[model samples]
Target: MSRYVLERVQLSAQNHPKRHAAVSCAIGGLLVAATSALSVIQRSETVSWPAVIAVAVIGGGAWAAAMAVFVVRLQRRMKPLPPETDPARVRAARRLMRNGELGPDPETNALAVRMAEQLQSIPRWKKFTTTAFLCTTILGVLVTAPAISDGEVGKSVFYGACTLFPLLMLTVGRARLDRHHRNAAEIRRAAEHRTNTEAER
Candidate 1:
């Protein structure tokens, strides 16, 4: 059952390749735009439109190239499922990809709980790095706060927003992960209770 679930998860990537690619590209573009804007904000008062355009072009090109490589590698790695495979399960897997939630199937929910548990066991170095990144972003927000008092409202707001973006994303992601874990755990417990009751009969 676990193997079946994993295979379906893999095949989900193949279900809407173009849609996935487009979303990824859009995210990359936004990141590049943010970086370019940050660069401009950190520059001299005499803004050079040509320089800003150059920065945007370079950032966009780099992001595009990296995304292309990623897509190629992902394509090469994904193996297509057999045509005779269950369409309902395939659709469920794709739905899971879209929203990080499993179906009501007890066994699938058990697997998801296990996967979530594994994800929670972060390495020491990774934990350290994550803490460091959060600290750096917080520091950025603090450093820019003084600019607001100095009457540079626009610069301060932009910098603060840029710094806060990562923190906001991390908070939202963590909340979602916790919700999924709790749901999976509940499903697993219910399945166990049912099995125990059946055994007593």
Candidate 2:
């Protein structure tokens, strides 16, 4: 059941690189717009509207081009699983990979069990990065609030929405990563217990 779900997701992503790339470019455009707005806000006393628009357009275009190329290359490297492959093992392997515990032969159960031991505790670097993203999210909202309250409701909404998009992504991505980590830890403990019971027998 879990294996089927995992494989379906993997196959969908692998088969739809263009869709993913389009989504990435959209997100990139939001980030670029937010950044351009921030620059304008910082120079409010001497802001040039034309320059800001030009910068945002150029930045967004460049980001879209780069992401399209990168996504295409990445997708090209992902090989599809054979019809005869075990989906359960593939699911386990991907779980390990997500937690950075996947070994050379990810499809092997024994290798996955041994590698899972490394995920017993969350790494400090992961915590630090999550904290950094949270801080940035908070800062982005705070910085955009005054502008949002000003007379320019239209412009404010545009800037706020653009800024909020990435912040939301950060928050959501963190939550998903934490969930994956928890699932990985549970799998590790189960594997360890099974190993010990087998050894005792």
Candidate 3:
């Protein structure tokens, strides 16, 4: 659990490819929640800000939870490493300068690229779904509050707009994350090939 959480954080990147996007998503959620709380506290009027803030909190939490679940599921799908792994495999994968007869293995790299792309795409749906869940939870809580009345039609409009925002955010964030991964994979492959040829000769 702890290890998976760590990996999640690494993938949620601000700038680098190595930062866990899962952990990043979780942290982003907490921050959104915190911002919502602050917005609620700072407001002078009994405006619909409370509902908005509550919704934001819920969305953020949902994003984090969805990502954490993804990390757990992905780990289960991965096969454990070998006890006597090939030395060439280690050198080819880990040491950029030590590549011998091996370059990037096409079968594994292609499989990985496909897997990563699938992960990147599927998780966007998870993100949006979680976001929708979060907003629903917040809206439910707010609706029951003494302040919010079902009688007011305008509040429904407010809820709809606020609820949709997180999914939008998730869509944009996921797109950027996938783009970076593709670029990183290409660079890694290129470096591996160059080193493999240098070592071969």
Candidate 4:
């Protein structure tokens, strides 16, 4: 049973890859690199404004560019072109869905419901991961707060944005959790309806 549960979890994750987690890790890596580079630059005897701006802009631009490319690639993977490649097929699919005939067959729907139930572990894990990240961010900020000059409001604001980024990410994951649960419930209901209808026949 445990093996089945694990298999279902793996399958579900494969179907809906957690690109957000990858992006978050990328951002975290960039942040750490930037912080290290800043420390190295500041250790020099002469830290000119041009040098500071150059480092900041280069680091930030690289991070932004990486994120943009990642998003584009992820969007392509999430929404493939097969369905849209043929207009006739696309129209037919839309019509079936509209007429409530596009859903998975009975056996598939039952399997999906079971898979979804096992997949509940995903959202719970997400919640726990989010909470852990939040606590770590808070602690990190507190430990590093003294390093920044009190009058450097811009730097403080940047730090705040960095902290909030993870929170925003986890919030979206939580939303996906709710969506997953709703979809699972709908599949279960559909499967039960089918079972009853067949029995009555």
Which lDDT value does model 1 have at 17?
55
Better of 1 and 4 by lDDT: 1
Ranking by TM-score: 1, 2, 4, 3
lDDT of each: 0.60, 0.64, 0.50, 0.54
Q: What would the per-residue lDDT of candidate 4 be over residues 62-143, giving only the tens digit for each residue?
A: 7656665654454434423232133333333333322333254433343454544444433355557777778867865873
Model 2: C-alpha RMSD to truth? Answer: 7.9
lDDT assessment of candidate 3:
0.50
Backbone N/Cα/C clashes per model: 0, 0, 10, 0
lDDT for each residue of candidate 3 in 31-148, tens digit (9 for 90 to 100): 7677566545433356476686677778778877777666555544434233243434433343221221223575444333433333334334655666676776576456434234
Q: Which ten residues in a row have the lowest lDDT in candidate 3?
A: 94-103
Can you list the residue pairs that collide in candidate 2?
none
Candidate 1 whole-model C-alpha lDDT, 0 to 1 = 0.60
lDDT of 4 at 190: 66
Q: Which lDDT tens digits does candidate 2 get at residues 1-201?
A: 463975655555556767767877778877877677666655475768787788777877787888788766666655544445565665667666466443445246554553344333324366677676677667667767777777667556765675676676577866876776676666676666766887999
Instruction: Sort the predicted structures by lDDT, highest score first.
Output: 2, 1, 4, 3
Task: Give the better candidate number (2 or 4) by lDDT.
Answer: 2
Q: Considering TM-score, which of the candidate structures 2 and 4 is the better prediction for this target? A: 2
Candidate number that wins on lDDT, 2 or 3: 2
Candidate 4 has a TM-score of 0.42
TM-score of each: 0.52, 0.46, 0.32, 0.42
